[model samples]
Target chain A: MPKIVDHDQRRSEIVEAFLSVVARKGLPAATSRAIAAELGVGTGALWHYFDGFDAVTAAAYKRVTERTNERIAGASTGLRGLAAVDAMMHEILPLAKETLDEAQVVVGFWGRLAANETLSAAEADVSDMWGGRLRDHLHEAVDDGDLASGTPVDGIVDLLLSISVGQQVHAVMATPLLDPARQLALIEQCLSPWRRTPRQPGETVTR
Target chain B: MPKIVDHDQRRSEIVEAFLSVVARKGLPAATSRAIAAELGVGTGALWHYFDGFDAVTAAAYKRVTERTNERIAGASTGLRGLAAVDAMMHEILPLAKETLDEAQVVVGFWGRLAANETLSAAEADVSDMWGGRLRDHLHEAVDDGDLASGTPVDGIVDLLLSISVGQQVHAVMATPLLDPARQLALIEQCLSPWRRTPRQPGETVTR
Candidate 1:
C-alpha cells in the first residue's frame, strides 16, 4: 500500500511539472525532455511513468479539470441559485489570469483527445458533471423565485455548459469572444430572461 | 505563370488528400505516410510540396475555411435575415457528416495553431469573419420586423458567434451538446427573447 501511494505521488509530481512547463513556456515547448528537465530527471524517466506523450497530456487534462472543480467548490461556498451559478461559471470561464492559463493548457490537449479514443475514454464526460451541477443551481434559483417558473432550466444548462467548454478554445484563439465583458454579457443573457426582476443589460450580476 | 499555377495546384491536391485521409479514417490516422499513400507517393514527396506537417495542417485549415465559406454563400443565396442565419449556421454546425468530419479536421489543427505562431499567423481570424456576417444578418432580422425593436443585437451577435465556433469542438466531443436538436435549440435560445413572435419551447424556427 505504501509503495502504491508513493507511485501515485510520483505521477502527481510529474503531471505538476508538465503543467509548470506549459505555464512558463507554451504547450509545444513542454516536451518530455522539458518535463524531465523540470523534474531533474532523464527524458527516459517520463516513459517509465507515462505510456507516452498522449498519456501525459491526458493526465494534464484531468489535472486541470480537478483544479477547476476545486475552484468551483471554493467559489460557490454558502451560495445558491443564480448567485451560485454565476460564481461557479466565473471559476471556469477563463476570466482571470490563472483560469486563462488553465484554458491554454487544456485547449492544447483537446486535439489529442479528438485523435486518441483510448486517452479520451479514460477521462469522464465533462458535460454530465458540469451540466448536472448547473442544473441543480438553476433549480435552486427557481425554488427561491430568482428565476421564473417554467424557466427552461434544462435548455439553459445545455447552453451554459456549451459555453463553458467552447470558451476555452475561444480564449486560446485570443479573439474578442474571450473579452470578459462580452462573456459576462452572455452569462447574463442566459439568466436575464429567467430572472424575476429581469436585470437590465450592462448591469453587473454578482461581481 | 503556368509553372506557378502548377505549384499551387499541386499543393491543393496534397491538402485535399490530407482531408480524404481524415474523412475516411480520423485525424490521427491522417499522417504523412498515410497522406502520401492516399496519393500513391512517398512521404518525402509531401515534404517537398509543404514545409512540414504543420504546414500541411495550416494549408488544410485554410482550405476547410474556404470550403465552408463557399457553402455558406451557396446556402444563403437569395436568403436574408434570420432565414439566412439559420442556413449559414446549419452549414457550419457539424450537424451533418460532412461538417462533422470537417470539425474533426479543424479541431485537430487547433493544437498545432496554439503551439506554432508562424503557422497560426498564416490563418485569418474566424471570429471577425463569422461575427461580421452574423451581425449583419441579425440587423436584417430586426429591420424586417422579425425581432423586437430594442433587441440587444450586439450581445446576441456575440452569443451566437461564440456558439458557432464553440459547437465545432463540442460536436467533435460527441456529447449531447452535439445533438442537432440541442444545438438548434441553443440557437433558438439566443433568438427567442428577441423575436417578435416568440417561439414556444418545442417549436421549430425554420426547416
Candidate 2:
C-alpha cells in the first residue's frame, strides 16, 4: 500500500519549523536553508510545500494568528462583561515564557510589515479579527449594564489594543517597569470610567 | 589654503543621508552604497566619519532619538501638569507628514532591535528618558491637586508610553481607524480619571 501523506499536517510541520527558526534567530536569518535545517530536512523539502521563503514565512504568520485566535476564543469562552474582556486581555499579555515567545515573534514582524505589503495585510487581518472580538465583548458589557450607555466602544477598543501592543513590546524588551500585575491594573483603570454612572452634564464624553 | 571640513556637521549630514536612504528604501536596502548615492558622494566619503554600515546605522539611530527628544522638549518647554503631558504626547503622534516619517523609521527599527542587543539598548534608553519625563509631568499634576495624592504615577506613565508606542505603529501602518484627532482624544481619555477630583471613601480610585 502507498504511504499516507497528510498534506495539511506536513504544511503545519513546515510552519512550526519556520517559527522555531524565527524564534531562535530573528526573522532575517530564517532563510529556507535554516528552516530546513530546523526540520532536519533538505532545503528542497520546503519547496515541495511552499513556493519559496516568502511562502513559508506567510504560512508561519498565519499559524501565529490562528493560534492567537484560538487562545483568545478559549479564554473568553463562557465569560461575559468585564470578566470576558479581562480574560481576553490576559490571553494576549506575555505573562509566561511561551506567550513571551509569541509576543517576540509578533513584534519582530512589525518592521517587515512596514516595508512588505503582503505581510502588512496579513497582520491587519489578524488585528481586525482581534479588534472585532473585543468590540463584541464591549457591546456585551453595555448590554449587560456593566458599561454605561453611550460608551464609545470603538475608541475603547482602540485604546485597549494600543495598550496591549505597547505592553507586548515592553514585555519582550524585559522592561522592569510593567510586569503582568501592573499591566492588568492599568487595563482595569482604563475601563473604570465606563463602569461609572452615565456621563453627567458638562462632563467630557471621550469618543 | 586647505578646505575646512566640520567633523560634527559632516557626521550630521551623513546621518541625514542614511535616514533619507532608509526612508526611500527599507533598512536592509539602505546599504553604504545607497547612502553614499543619496548624498551624491562616494561610499568612501562615509568612512571619514564612521567605520562602516553598522556605524552609520548606529549614528542614524542616535540622531532619531535625539531629534525626538528635542521635539518633546520644545513642545513641553513652558507647559506643566496634564498640559505638559498632552504636549509631549502630541509631539510623538504622527499628526504631520514629517512626524509620520519619523514614526515609520522608528517602527522599522523595532524589528532590528528584536535581534540586536545594541539597538535594543539604544531603544530602551530613549524609552527610559521619555518615561521619566512623563512621570515628572504626572508628579506635577498630583502636586498641583490635578491628580489625587496617592495616584500611581509610575504605572500611569508606563500606560501612557505604551499607548504612545502603539499609536506610532498604527500611524505607520496607516491604520485608518485612528486619525490624529482621535489619537489625542484617546490619550486624554486615558488620563481623565487622574484629572478628576479626589475620590472620597467608597469612591473608585483609578491609578
Candidate 3:
C-alpha cells in the first residue's frame, strides 16, 4: 500500500518552520535554506510544500491572521459594547511570551510590506477584518444605549486600532513604560468618552 | 596642501548614503557595497569613515534620531502643556514624503533591534528621550491646571508614545482608514479629556 501523505500537515510544518526562523532571526535571514534547516529538511523540500519563499511567507502570514481572528472571535463571543471591545483588545495584545514572538514576526513583516505588494494586500485584508469587527461592536454599543447616539464609531475604531498596533510595538520592544496593567488602563481611557452618559447642556466632563 | 576632509561632514555624508540605501532597498540590501554605490564611491571609502557595516548602521541611526529630536524640539519650543504635547506628536508623525521615508527606515530598524544589542540600546535611549519630553509636558499640564488632579500622567505618556509609533506604522503602510485628518482628529480626542473642565458632582458632561 502507498504511504499516506497529509499535505495539510506538511504545509503547516513548513509554515511553523518559517515563523520560527523569522522569529529567531529577523526576516532577512529567513531564507529557504534556513527554514528547511530549521525543520530538519533539505531546501528542496520547502518548495514541495510552498511555491517559493514568497508563498511560504504568505502562508505564514495567513496562519498568523487566522490565529488572531480565532482568538478575538472566541474571546468576544456573547459580549457587546465596551466589554466586547475590551475582550478583543485583550486578546490581541502581546501579553504572553508566544504572542510576543508573534508580535516580533508581525513587525518583521512590516518592513517587507513596503516592497511586497502581495504581502501588503494580505496585511490590509487582515487589518480591515479586525477593524470591521471592532466597528461592528461599536455600532452594537451605540444601538444598545451603551454609547451616545452620535458617538463617532469610525473614529473610535481607528483610534483603538492605532493604539493596539502601537502597544504591540512597545510590548515587543520591551519598553519599560507599557506594562500590561498600564496598557489596559490606556485602552479604558480611550473608551471612556464613549461610555459616558449623553451630556446635559453646559456640563463640564474633565476636572 | 593635501585634500582636507571635514570628518564630521564626511561622516554625515556616509550616514546619508546609508539611509538612502535603506530607504530605497530595505535593510537587507543596506550592505557597505550598496551604500558606497549609492554615494558614487568605492566600498573602501565607507571603511575609511566607519569601522564596518555595523558602525555605518549605528551612525545612520544616530543621525536619524538627532534629526528627529531636533525637529521635535524646534516645533515644540515655546509651547506648553497639552499644546506642547500636541506639537511634539505632530512633529513626530509622518506628515510628508520625507517623514514617510523616515518611518520606513524606522520600521526597518525595529526588525534589526531584536538581533542587535547596540541598535536596541540606541533605540531604547531614543524612546526614553521621547517619553521623557512628553512626560515633562504632561507634568506641566497638571501643574498648570490644564488637566485634572491625579490624571495619570505616566499612563498618558505611554499611551501617546504607543499611539504615535502605531500611527507611524499605519501612515507608512498607507492604511486607508487613517488619513492625515483622521490621524490628527484621533490625537485631538485623546487630548480632549484634559482639555475639558472638571465635572461637578452629579453632573453629566458628555453633551
Candidate 4:
C-alpha cells in the first residue's frame, strides 16, 4: 500500500511555518514567496494547502490560538481550583520565548486583521471566543470561592484579555529594559488587587 | 513680497496630509506616495517638508497627540471638582465624527508602531509626554480636592489609558451600537465607583 499523509496535519505544518516567518519578518513582508522560501517548499505546494493569502493568514492565526488554548489546557492536569486559574492566567501572557514569539506574530496579525473586512469578523470572533473562555474560568473560580465576591466576572475577563494584549503591546513597543520577566512581575503586581489571597512574589517561570 | 511659508506651518500641513491619508486608508497603506496624493502635492514636495517616511509618521503622531491634549485642555473650563475631571475623561474618547476618524487611524498606528523600532520609540516618547501631562492634571485635581485623596496617581493614569485604548479597540473591533450619547453614559457608569458622593435618584449631572 502507498504511504498516506494526513492532509490536515500537513496544512498545520505549513501554517506553523507561516507563523515563524511572520514572527521574524513583519506581516507585510510575509508574502507567499517568503513563506514558501522559509518552508523550503515551492510556492505551489503551499497553495495546495491554502487557497490564497487570506486563507493562509487566517490559518496561521487559528493555529496560534489553538496551540495557545492547548498549552493552557495541558497545564491544568493534577491541579484544580484556584491553582488551575492562576496557572492559566500566568500562561495568558507570553512568558516563554516560543510564546513571546507567538505573541509578537499575533500582534502583527491584529493590524492586518483590523483593516481587512474579511479578517475583521474573524478577529472579533476570536477575541470574543477568548473572552468567553476566560469568563468561564473566572466563573468557575468564583463558584469555588477562590475569587472575591462582587468581583465582576465579565469585567475580570475583559481585564485579563486587555492586560494580556496590553502586555504584548508593551513588550513590542518598550525597550528590552523590561523583558518578559519584569513584565510578568508588573502584571502580577497589578493583579494583586483582585486576588482572593496574596501571591508570594517570585520570578517568572518558563513552562 | 510674496507669501513666505514658515517651516512650522509647512510641517503642520504635511502632518495633516499624512493623518488624512491614514484615516482614509490605514497605517500600512499610508505610504509617502499616497500621502502626497492625498495632499494634492508631489512626493518631492512632501520630502521638502519632512525628511522621510519615519520622520513623517513620527510627526503625524506628534501632531495628533498635540491636538488631543489641546482639546482636553479646553474641556476643563466651566466645571469644578470631579465634574471637571469627568468632563476631561469624556473628551478622551471619540465624541464626534472627526475625532472618531482620527482614533481609527491612531489605533491602527499602534500595532505597526509596536512592530517597528523607530516608530515604537516615537510612540513611547509620545506616551510619556501625554502620560506626564495627565499626571500633572490629576495632581492639580487632587490638590483642588476635586479627586479623592490617597488615590494612586499612576494607577489612575494607567486606568485612563487602558480604558481609552479599550474603548477604541471595542469601537474598531465591534459594531458601533453605542451612539455618542450612550457611550458617554457608559463612561459615567465606569466613573461611578470612584466618585466621592452618590448621585441623587435619576440625577444625570453631578452637583
Candidate 5:
C-alpha cells in the first residue's frame, strides 16, 4: 500500500501557505515560489496538491471568503438587526491588520480572476451571500424601528455591497480615509438616513 | 544619423498598443508579447521603449488617467456645482461601453500596482485630483443652493470618491446594479438627501 497522503489536508496547507505569504509580504510578493518556500517545499511541490498557481489562488480566495463568513458568524452571534449588520460589516471591512490582509488577498484574486477564466470568481455567490445577510439584518432593523419603515432596502443593499467590494481594492490601493474610524464612518453614512436616532459621539466601535 | 528612431513616438505607439490590447481582448491578454504583436513588432522591440512590461503598464496607466481627465474636462465644460459633479462622475463611472472599458483598464492597473512598487500607482494624484474636483463642484453646489447649506461637503467628497473607486471593481466583478440607470441611481442616492428637491422622474441619465 502506498503511503497515505491526505490530499484535502495538503491542499488546505497549500492554501494556508499562500495566505501566509500574502499576509507577510502583501499580494504582489505572494507568488508561487514564495508560497512554496513558505511551505518548506520546492515550487513544483505545490502542483502535487493544486493544478497550478491559479488553482492555488482560487483556493485561497475560497479560504478567505470562508474565513470571513466564519468571522461574521462569530462576531454577530446573539446580535440582531442593525447590531448584526454592523458587526458583519466590521468583520468584512479592513479595519485591522488581520482584516486588511484578507482584503489584500481578496483583491489580488479578483485581479487574477478578471484575467483567468479557468478559476472561479464565485461573484454571484459572494454578492448573494452578503446581499441576503444584509437584507435580513436590514429588514430586522426596520422591524425593530431602528431603520425607517420606508427604507429602500434593495437599493441600500446594493450600495452596501458595492462599498464592500470597493473597499477591498481600496485597501490594496492604500486609499485615504482607510483608517478604522473612517471605515465605520462610511457605514454610518449609509445607515444614518434611516436611523430613528442619529449616531451619537463615541458610539462607533473603533478597532 | 545611423538611423532615425522616434523614441517618443515609438513609446507612445507601445502605450497605445497596450491600451488597444486591453480594449480588444482584456487585461490578462494584454501581455508584452501581445502588445508587441499588436503593433506588428517582435516582443523584443518593446524593451527599447519600456524598461519592462511593468513600465508599459505604468505608461498605459498614465495614458488612461490623462484621457479620463480630458473626458471629464470636455463633459463638464459648461456645467458647475452639482451639475458639473454629475457630469464628471458620469464620465468616471463605468456606465457605458467606452467608460466601462476604462474602468476595466483602471482596475487591472490597480491590481498590478498593488504588486509592483516600481510602477507608480499614483494613488495620491488620482485621489487628490478627483478630491479637488469634487470639492470644487460640491462647494459650488452648496453656494448655489443646489445642496443644503449645512451639508457635510468633505464627507460627501470622500463618499463620492469611495463610490467611484468601488464602482471600478464593481464593473469588473459585474456586480448587480451596474447598469447605467442603477449607477446613476447611486449618485442620486448620494445627492437626494442634500437636494432641496427630491430626484424628479427621468432626472437620471441612463447612459
Candidate 6:
C-alpha cells in the first residue's frame, strides 16, 4: 500500500517554502516556478496541493495569519489592560527573525492582493479578524474601567491595530523605532496616558 | 535654435507619471513602457531623461520623499511638543488619498530596495533625514521641558517613526483605525503619560 501523506502538513510545508522565497525576494520572485525550484519539487507538484500560484500565495498568507493570531491569542490569555494589548502588539510586530520575515511576506502580499479580488477578500478577512480581537480587548478594558468610558471602543481598537501594523513597517524599514526594547517602552508609555492611575514606579502592568 | 525642452521639468513630469503608475499599479507594473504610455510620450522619451527604469523609480521615490518632507515642514512651521509630533506623524501616515497612495509606493519601494545596496543606502538616507527632523523637534520638546527630562530622545524618535509607519500599514489594511483624527487623539493620550505633571484628573497610569 502507498504511504499516506498528511495533506495539511504537506500544504503547510509548501506554504513555508512560498513564504521564505517571498520574504527573501519580493512578491514577483515568489512565482510558481521559483517556489517549486526553491522547494526542489516539480512545478506540477505544487498544483497537486494548491490550485495555482494565487491559491498557494493565499494559503501561505493564511498560514502566517493563523500562526500570528494563535500566538497573540496565547499571549493574551488571562491578560488585561495595556498589558494584554501590548502583548498582542508585540506578537504582531516584526522583531524575531521568523516574525520579521512573516511581516515582509504579509506586506508584500497586501500589495499583490490589492488588484486581485480573491486575495483581497482573504486579506480583508484576516485584517478584520485581527481588528475584532483588538476591539474585544478594548471593550474589555472599558468594561473593567481601565479605559475612559467615553473613549470610542471602536476607535481605540482601530488605533491599536494601526500602531501594530505601523510597527511592522518600522521594523522592516530598520527605522530607529524598530528596536524591540524601545518599542516596548514606547508602547507602554503610549498606553500610560490613557490609564486612570499613573503606573506605579515599579508595577508590572502585565501582572 | 532647435526647441530645447526643460530637461529638469521633463524629468519631473516623468517622475509624476512613474508615481501615478506606481500608486495605481504595483511597482512591477510601472515599467518604462507603461510610464511612457501614461505620459502620452514615446517609449524612447523616458530614456532621454533617465538612464532606465531604476533611475526613474529612484527619482520618483525621491520626489515623493521630498514632497512629504515639504508637507511636514510646511505643516509644522513653529509647532511644538505633541502638536509638532502630531503634524509630523499625520503627514507620514496614510491619512488622505494622495498620502495613502504615496505610502503604498514608499512601502513597496522600500521592500524592493532592502537587498540592493545602492537602493537601500538611498532609502536609508531619506529615513535618516526624516529622523533628524524628528530628533530636532524632540530635542526642542525636551529643551522646553514639555517632555519629561529623563526621556530618551532617540528612543522617542524611534517610537514616533515606528508608530507612523505602523499606522500606514494599519490604514492600508483597512483596520479600524483608518481615521487620522482618532489616531491623533490616541497619540496625544499616549504621550500624556510621559509628561511631568502628576495624576491629572482624567489621566490614569496603567503601567
Best by DockQ: 1
lDDT of each: 0.84, 0.72, 0.72, 0.62, 0.79, 0.68
lDDT of 6 by residue, B1-207 (tens): 123558888899999988888678755577788889999989997898988665675677688888988998898887876567767777777778888777666655654443233554556465567678888877777788878877667755655566666665555556556666766655554455456664356552221
**Fnat, one value per model:** 0.60, 0.46, 0.40, 0.19, 0.45, 0.35
User: Candidate 5's chain A scores what TM-score?
Assistant: 0.92
Q: After superposing candidate 6, which stretches have Cα over 4 Å from the reference? A: A1-13, A20-31, A44-55, A78-83, A114-118, A138-156, A194-207, B1-11, B21-31, B41-55, B78-83, B114-118, B138-156, B192-207
Model 1: clashing residue pairs? none
Which one wins on TM-score?
Answer: 1
Where in model 2 is the C-alpha error above 4 Å?
A: A1-10, A22-31, A44-55, A148-151, A196-207, B1-11, B22-31, B44-55, B148-152, B197-207
**Model 6 per-residue lDDT tens digits across residues A83-133:** 677778778877687787776666656544532435556664655777777
* Candidates ranked, most accurate by TM-score first: 1, 5, 2, 3, 6, 4
DockQ metric for all predictions: 0.67, 0.38, 0.33, 0.30, 0.55, 0.29
Please, what are the lDDT tens digits per residue for candidate 2 over residues B1-207? 122458888888988987786666655566788878888999898898886654565677678778877988887777888778877887777777666767666766675565455665555366678888889888998999888787768767777878877877776566764587778767766766566563354542222
Q: Which wins on DockQ, candidate 2 or candidate 6?
A: 2
Model 1: lDDT equals 0.84
Model 2: fnat (fraction of native contacts):
0.46
Chain A only: give the TM-score of model 6: 0.77
Question: Candidate 1's residue-wise lDDT over B127-182, tens digit each?
Answer: 78988898898999999999888888888877887787678878777787888888
Candidate with the larger DockQ of 3 and 5: 5
lDDT minimum window of 10 residues, candidate 2 chain B: B198-207
Question: Any runs in candidate 1 off by more than 4 Å, and if so which?
Answer: A200-207, B200-207
Clashing pairs in 4: none
The 10-residue segment with the lowest total lDDT in model 4 chain A: A184-193
Of 1 and 4, which scores higher on TM-score? 1
Give one digit per residue, the lDDT tens place, for model 4 in B4-24.
558778788878877777667
Better of 5 and 6 by lDDT: 5
DockQ of 3: 0.33
Model 6 has fnat of 0.35
* TM-score, per-candidate, Cα-based: 0.96, 0.82, 0.81, 0.75, 0.93, 0.75
Residues A95-153, candidate 4: write the lDDT tens digits. Answer: 66666666666665565555455667566365567666667666776777766766556
